[model samples]
Target chain A: MIAVLGLVVGVVAGLLVRPEVPAAVEPYLPIAVVAALDAVFGGLRAMLDGIFDDKVFVVSFLSNVVVAALIVFLGDKLGVGAQLSTGVVVVLGIRIFSNAAAIRRHVFRA
Target chain B: MSDHDRTNGHRFRAELPAEVTAPPSAAEETPGERTPAALTGRQRLVKGLWPPRVTRAQLIVALLLFGLGFGLAVQVASNSDGDSALRGARQEDLVRILDELDDRTQRLEDEKQGLEKQRGELENSSDQAEEARKQTVEKERQLGVLAGTVAAQGPGITMTVQDTKGRVEADMLLDAVQELRAAGAEAIQVNGVRVVAGTFLTDSGDTVSVDGNKINAPYRFKVIGKPQDLEPALNIPGGVVQTLEKELATVTVERSSKIVVDALRAAERPDYARSSSR
Candidate 1:
């Protein structure tokens, strides 16, 4: 019961802590979407007993979202606002692969 | 070691039945049993950025990581916001500069139009002067032809007047020329030079001059008028000679017959009008 409570609260708070976006941030909204997917996948993996590699899930989800947002923000500053989204997707994809492996490990344990 | 490990939880669970393998329902638990407390959401988030474990060392590491990540997020957000504001300022500056350039270009176009108009006016005046020069050349050519044709004609009239007596003035010569022209002269000359509408006179050395050529006593002026009307008009009582001789008291007049003047010849000109007529 306690473990389940911790998971529910962690997931909910993660969802709610979304920082305010700016108009200059509009081009980066797609990166935000990828970050959202990373969190959703992490939560779903948790629910399904897909992988309980807590470290993997937290680091992957955090770095994917945060680094993606940072790259997009940096690209906007560098005047190549469109290309930052590519970096966002790339980092998100890397994090996704790492977490997916963890998911597979526990879920497909032979 | 055996004495300290005697009351452990593992030893207690080992004493329970196989029913313990199944999830423990509320009905299976003894009433008022103590349950483990759940960690708060803030505690879970603080620990999330760290290694997955629970110990004094791990907790300390988790707290450090949480501080680092939190500080990084706040700093990045603040700095990026400032950068965004600066970008907006640059865009505004660019737009303003473009507008100024547009305004300058518009003014330059207007100035160019005004200069073009002035240039057109100058060109028009130049073209007029060129046309006048061409007409003067044509007239000079016609006069050359006239001189050739009229060389054979003979017998003309002559009149003379002067300010040598210190009384006649430049107007006296102009008056004489006017009267000769009115008397139906075909051609006239003053001081051995052809006199036309462009003739001018000025005073020099106590005598009035014609076309800058001087004359002495009995200044010889010639005219080719029809003899009958030519002599009668001037010799009529109280006429031009009477008037001029009365004033200068040194003027003279003379007339003759068989005066000759000629027609100016012209070379053929291309009739572009015919080809362009239609």
Candidate 2:
């Protein structure tokens, strides 16, 4: 439930800062997914360590998502959505690799 | 942690740090001590990532997250039940607009051809039908006046847009005005009212009201700016006309030699959008 409550950190923040997007932004959906999953993985790690502090997790999750989104938005504003999304995938790709390694150890260790 | 483990009739060995590996059986055991494998922080990290089996904590967190996500989805879903209605309205508006554009575009083209013929006549022969001549001159005056009003500069530009079907919306108007402002327009007026942050949108089933004024066509707008600055405001890509070309709305812009935009009253605030910090 705590992890569940933690996900609101993104949704509420999303509605707060996410502008009413037009259909043109459909392509950036994947970047948003990566950012969300990154937050989830990071949150689960925090919970297991007995450090599931709401403020830290929520703020961290929100900022992480927003910063990624904002960069894309800025790129969109600057007419560079495709390039910015590519930039996002590069950083998120590295984070995904690191996070997957962590998840592997978490589940398989005896 | 153990150097060798026997599991399911197979022996497996691991290379681990001294703290992580179990001590030799000959070593004296400490009283009330944790297992040797528990000594390494890295092992704990590995264990947290992929335990051999699921833990109660993981189940609780997953269930909780799903429930919360569902509840939020439901809440937002209920509130936006107007999506269908909005879509319907938008479609209806679009159909009406296309028809109007078809008719108006043809009319404008015909008018342009007529004006051209009139010009050709003046060049070829001076004498023309007086009544036809007067009517053409009147239209020219209106267009000229409006163009001049947009060109003049004291404050801003007012663009009055309306649809015969009463379908022009505040959002549409807002978008156009925003574009104009973005194009360096100092200020703007729509339907004789000033554009300000507090400007609101209200619907009386047909016409959408702006700033509490029951404005209808012929939507006359006046602007105060250099003709050069204001004209470009209306021509940018994806600008005013594109946004507001809804089916039931007809937009006619006139720039007058001396356009008067009445000082407007403060508009009411919208309740739907709230401040982020608040």
Candidate 3:
């Protein structure tokens, strides 16, 4: 519940302040956002399973965004940035679907 | 290890009883609780990924989840509001948009071409009107020269009358001037005085006055016309030279290649002489 409250507050603050991302880092924002989404789903599933670890969630969330951006940056150097971004999105999307399914089962008990 | 050993191990695990295969509950107090060694590989795998414990870890996990949710919201907002909407568009949508833009450009180019054609036609019509105006101005200049309101120069004849007997009258000079006019004289001057349509001559007793200017004996007349026609007109039998010679005056006519008639008259602006349509 506190986590949900923090999310709402952060969103409101972000909207009000409207922080501008630097031009150099702008290319990575979409990928980082997708990675952050994967971490949120994983965290939700963990919370539902009664094994929600704050340290693990924070570490995983930070690592997911960083690693996703790093992969794209490296792919750009290799001239495969688009393909790498697609691969990352596909993997993260599958994970999100599975975690969402688990959360649904826990909530509905079906 | 190998595929065969893995298959055999899976088969043995499948043969275990339901009670032996059940997961160990940490909270349950039972006498026949299974040891950690009795846990299956699947159970261990699940435990590694998700630890069923509520502790300080929840705080860190919750904070990170909050951050993730915030980032997601911000990303969504920025993506919708930013200038790079094409980055999120599908390939087919981008192609359709490009086609529409090309069509619009082609239409604009055609419109511009049409306007350019119209401008060209307008310029052509204006050029024709200017040419016509120049021709009219040239016609007016020729008319002004003939009417004696403008100066004129051309091949013609000059005549001089030496009336040693003082018998030459203004009427006789007037007759000579009329004869030149009938023979198509473009311009004429008598004794430094211009001759025009409104010119009047009078006998001034031993002199002739043309347009209120008196000219003495040795009356020289400069006439501008076709030299062939003017010289023949003066030499015609019973013409002005013959009549003037009978009056005891020596008349001489000479043809010249260039004769100047520098005379100007102000054009009349008649308030009552408006042109009728007929």
- Judged by DockQ cut-offs, is candidate 3 incorrect, acceptable, medium or high? incorrect
Residue B86 in model 3: shift from native, Å? 5.5
Residue by residue across B117-197, what tens digits does model 3's lDDT show? 999999999999999999999998898886667888989999999999999999999989888988889899898788887
| Best candidate according to DockQ | 3
Off by over 4 Å in 2: A4-30, A47-53, B1-278
**Residue by residue across A56-80, what tens digits does model 1's lDDT show?**
4445556656766788787768876
TM-score of chain B as predicted in candidate 2: 0.35
Task: Give interface RMSD, every candidate, in order.
Answer: 14.6, 11.9, 9.0
Instruction: Please give, for residues B1-278, the per-residue lDDT of candidate 1 as tens digits.
Output: 11111323332322233234223333434565533213222223334434455544334334333433433343345446765554433343567778999999999999999999999999999999999999998886556533432332456576666545676667776777777778886577665656654568888866767767775555667677666677776777777777777885655566677644443223334456355667
User: Model 3 chain B — which ten-residue stretch has the worst lDDT?
Assistant: B1-10
Per-candidate clashes come to 3, 26, 5
DockQ for the candidates, in order: 0.06, 0.04, 0.15
lDDT of 3 by residue, A14-55 (tens): 677666656667668789988887878776655444444555
What is model 2's native contact fraction?
Answer: 0.07
After the best TM-score superposition of candidate 1, give how far the Cα of residue B163 lies from its true spot, in angstroms: 6.4
Clashing pairs in 3: A53-B57, A54-B57, A54-B58, A54-B60, A54-B61
Among incorrect, acceptable, medium and high, the docking class of model 2 is incorrect
Whichever of 1 and 3 has more DockQ, that candidate is 3
